[model samples]
Target: MTKNIEHQFSMLVREIRKEFVGNGPKEISTRFVGSWAVSEMKGNLTNIEKFMMGSKEGEKMVHEARTGLVKKIYSDLSVRRKFEDLAGAAILRIFSDIDIEADIAMTIFVFDRPLISKEK
Candidate 1:
């Protein structure tokens, strides 16, 4: 990636963290590859769902929240404008897949083709 692309990608991650990290222990990282931007996050859970991953009800709620997050990212004009140029293409789709292991919540952000530049 060029310097500009790297900067745009970094900004995307920052936006995501700012929107989602809300008073929680969270770790975030991102990468751009083949017209895609991928992000991963591990965050602390609230007491209401402290062992959320281990149960069906908790998992359902988490999945629902992830969908809402994906929607917010797509709908936010600031985020869209920041990425549109760097991508040089419109985003095809955005979604999150999640998992839990050893009491940790992990989320993976998948931006389908056109999320980033394919010029490389």
Candidate 2:
């Protein structure tokens, strides 16, 4: 299962990189961080058993994370300026292809409101 998930993640990276960089360089400097990175960071916080039991909720969470990370990559001004509008359009295209609830997906991707006060 881990291997399959890793493979899927790699495929996603390749797809996004192809859209963003074409065949120009092996690496391109961009502020758009990979969703896999976000997933890895947050996945540990998510309970696997709970996720399995709450399949619908789990799917929602996963979809939101995917959409949100993509949006962040596309919307970051520094990143967008470097990649041009193609990044934004590519993100939209990817999101459109996904069958998940569109409004919820978009909302999840939109920038979150900043905390008014820092937690101590």
Candidate 3:
């Protein structure tokens, strides 16, 4: 059941990224840790972004743009509501970062409560 939730959550996250960024990660692996859902993604850089990575200044710009954009995108009330409904928990915050050279990104969803139910 938990695995199913993780898969669904990952798909939703991918969809969100594709919608906002016009491209999604080639791969996404998500896991639940307490109240946090951590997703590691690969192949997230677009062709233009890959080219920009060739320069130090361009790399900084890409990093800043992607990181800031992702945070702002997730901060949308509608997006938050979607995640909340799917995860069965309210999202308190979101943390996201990326590595331009590696074409990797990490998104952590911090919930108000644990996503996994502990059986008594």
Candidate 4:
């Protein structure tokens, strides 16, 4: 099941890259962060506990993750806007498939910047 999820995630990333980056030598990268990364980082937390945590804690973590991700994505978008515009949307859509709510939240916050920039 995990393998299938990973495969689906990879395929999603590839499709996003094609839409944004095309077949360029360089690649657009997508990362999962926030509580998801923290939980993975801690390595000892149960999925239930992670999910059961109050919304406040989850929002805080997701905010922090969005800040970091936005910085990185903005830098990438600055240099590769033509090939990375859809990347953020693709990521948000991917998270929608998973049960992790924080992932979607973080993606929403992080994705807005590049999108606004593209419109200008």
* Among all candidates shown, the one with the greatest lDDT: 3
| lDDT by residue (tens digit), candidate 1, 11-105 | 56556546664533366555666666665556644455555656887778866675566577667777766666566666665655555343343
Q: Per-residue lDDT for 18-66 in model 4, tens only?
A: 4443421122223433312101111212354356546878745644543
Residue lDDT tens for model 3, 42-109: 99999998888889999999999999999899989999999999998999989999988888999999
Which 10-residue window of candidate 4 scores lowest in summed lDDT?
A: 35-44
| Candidate numbers sorted by lDDT from highest down | 3, 1, 2, 4
Q: What is the lDDT of residue 46 in candidate 4?
A: 32
Candidate 3 RMSD to the correct structure: 1.0
For model 4, state the Cα shift of residue 50 in Å: 7.7
Model 2 misplaced stretches (Cα beyond 4 Å): 1-54, 85-97, 100-120
Instruction: Report the alpha-carbon TM-score of model 3 versus the true structure.
Output: 0.96
Quote the lDDT for 18 in model 4. 42
Runs in model 1 with CA error above 4 Å? 1-8, 20-25, 44-54, 86-89, 100-120
Question: Which lDDT values do the candidates have, in the order given?
Answer: 0.56, 0.35, 0.93, 0.34
How many collisions per candidate? Answer: 0, 0, 0, 1
lDDT of candidate 2 over 1-120, digit per residue (tens): 434443443344445535653421132121223321211111112244235435787667766565565565556565534322322222222221123432211112111222122349
Q: Give the Å shift of residue 20 in candidate 4.
A: 13
Pairs with backbone N, CA or C atoms under 3 Å apart (clashes), candidate 1: none
